[model samples]
Target: MKQNRNFIVGITAILIIMMLASGCVNKPSEQTEPTQITVSAASTLTESFEEIVEQFKIENPEIDVQLNLASSGALRMQIEAGAPIDVFASASQQHMNLLDEKEMIVKDSRTDFAQNSMVLIVPITSELEITSVDSLLNDSVKRFVISDPEISPAGTYSKQSLVESGLWNELEGKAVLAETVKQVLVYVERGEVDAGFVFMTDAKIAKKDTIKIISTIPTSTDISYPITVLESSEHKKESQMFVDFVTGQKGRSILESHGFTA
Candidate 1:
């Protein structure tokens, strides 16, 4: 009888243990979904911004960043049209100003984080003796390219520099308008144009054997890049954190490494 009782007790204990084990196996584990934020930045920021985003991700593993690169003006238009953008980084103050004027950006959130210079680039194989902005007027240079001033801040700066140098009217006939500064670089790289104007950063990224920087527009016509959190951002805190990251020392280091001034 005592043996029977002992056997029953052992069976009961085993059943209890099995029940506890089964409960443990069936219990749900903790799951977390990362928050996503969209950033709209200019094409000029492609390399630098990508590096910055990577660093930001390491520091903020819970935040997922989505980058939308385009001409500053076009990005502003998208933000204005109510596209879901959490932050904006423009290659010029003009586009940021437009957003500020419309109250599309958070007040006091705008900050100029970097600067770039416009440069003239020619195909490496070209034998043109052109040396300065004035040389663009030479008959030998039949085709020159600049981003479209209507949508590209680099194009606007290029036009402003040419106008300041009293060469705008003379070069207008030979000017080829591109949609973005990268497009201008591509045109020059492919030898489609005699020469093209692009940001110094863009020029630096091109293969040395593919293109040559002939001249840089004076610094008086500086191109300032600004960043800001959008008023329409659903993840305002996350957007602000990204803005801080960009204006912080780490981001500056990345920008400077990419030939941008911070």
Candidate 2:
């Protein structure tokens, strides 16, 4: 009986040890779950931002970063409509201002993070001798692709450039507006349109052999990228960290590599 009791006790102890080992393996070393943040960034930052996010993830495995890329105006409206986003990175200060005016963002967290200039692009295969925005109005040019001014900051800037340069009224009929700058690039790359206006960064990616950079809009009409944390964010701390990361060395390098002025 004594021997049996000892064997039973040993078995029980072994089972208990195994259970503890399993618990240790299955349980998280930390008591709390890592924080996660959702970021709504401008479509212009897609490639560069993805690269930066990947680097950030390696360093901050504890924090999860969710990203949504779209037109700044659309993203702003989404936040206003109560989208569960933690951070907002806009292509223009105007959109960010609208969010600030409506109290949708944490005002103190807003900052201008990067800069970009507009460029006139044409398909590489096009024999059209287009050198500037003025050439876009030529009779032979059937269509001029640009982002939608109402939704896309690049479009708005491009329109503003045209209007400021006295081209909007003359070429109004020729204008082909796209929902996003990337879409405009697509139209130009596929030779769907004769020409288009996009950020220098986007032109760098979607337009290499398929498209050619004709000219850059004046620096006076440059757009500044602004970022802010949303007031409704449940992960404000992590969100701010993401914002900081984007504005910091890692983000700046990525932006620069993609042809953005940081």
Candidate 3:
């Protein structure tokens, strides 16, 4: 009878142990989707923003960033047309302001983070002695390029500066209007044009042996870059964090490295 009691006790203990072990077992955790946000930035910001996005992802492993680079005005239109962009980094305050006026951007989120200087660039192989803005007026500069003022902030800045200098009337005839600042750089880098007006940041990325910076063009506008969270964004929380990441010290450091002033 004692042996039977011992066996029954052993079986009860074993059952209890199995039940406890089963209760303690963990189920596999469900993987979560990363928060995805799209950033629409000015063409001149391409290199700097790309680097920043890489670092931002390292620090924010949960958020994914997508970049769409173009002229500030063109980006503004995209936002106006209901594109699914979460953030905007514009080279022109005018474009940002238009968005704000239309309630397209988060009102309190608009802030300027960096400034850029417009520059005159020419092909490095060019034998022409293009020394100054006045050089563009020479008979030798047949085909110069500027981004289209309607779509690009760089073009507007360049045109405004030339108009203020009373050189627009003559240069307009020679100007080949491109869609973006990067296109202006390409025109000069490929020797497609005699010269081009582009941001100093864009000039920095051009091939070292292909393009040369002649001079910095002073603009009537402040030339500061403004960034904002879009009002239409579905992920405002994540979007705001992205704006913070860009306007933070880390982003400034990256921008400075790319010839932009923070």
Best by lDDT, which number?
1
Backbone clash pairs in model 2 (N, Cα, C under 3 Å; residues 3+ apart or in different chains), count = 0
Descending-TM-score candidate ranking? 3, 1, 2
Give the runs in model 1 whose Cα sits over 4 Å from its true position: 1-26
Model 2, residue 65: distance off in Å is 0.7
Model 3 agreement with the true structure over 1-262: per-residue lDDT tens digits: 9999999999999988887788764558889999999999998898899999999999999999999998899999989989999999999999998988998888898889999899998999998879888899999889899999998999999999999999999888999999998988998999999999999888888987999889989877678999999999999999899889888999999999999899
TM-score of 2: 0.88
lDDT of 1 at 48: 94
Off by over 4 Å in 3: 1-25
TM-scores of all candidate predictions against the true structure: 0.89, 0.88, 0.90
Shift of residue 123 alpha carbon in model 2, Å? 0.8
Candidate 3 backbone collisions, by pair: none
Candidate 2 local lDDT, 18-97, one digit each (tens): 98888843655666676888889999989988888898899898998888999999998899899899999999888888
What local lDDT score does residue 61 receive in model 2, on the 0 to 100 scale?
89
> How far does residue 73 in candidate 1 sit from its true spot (Å)?
0.5
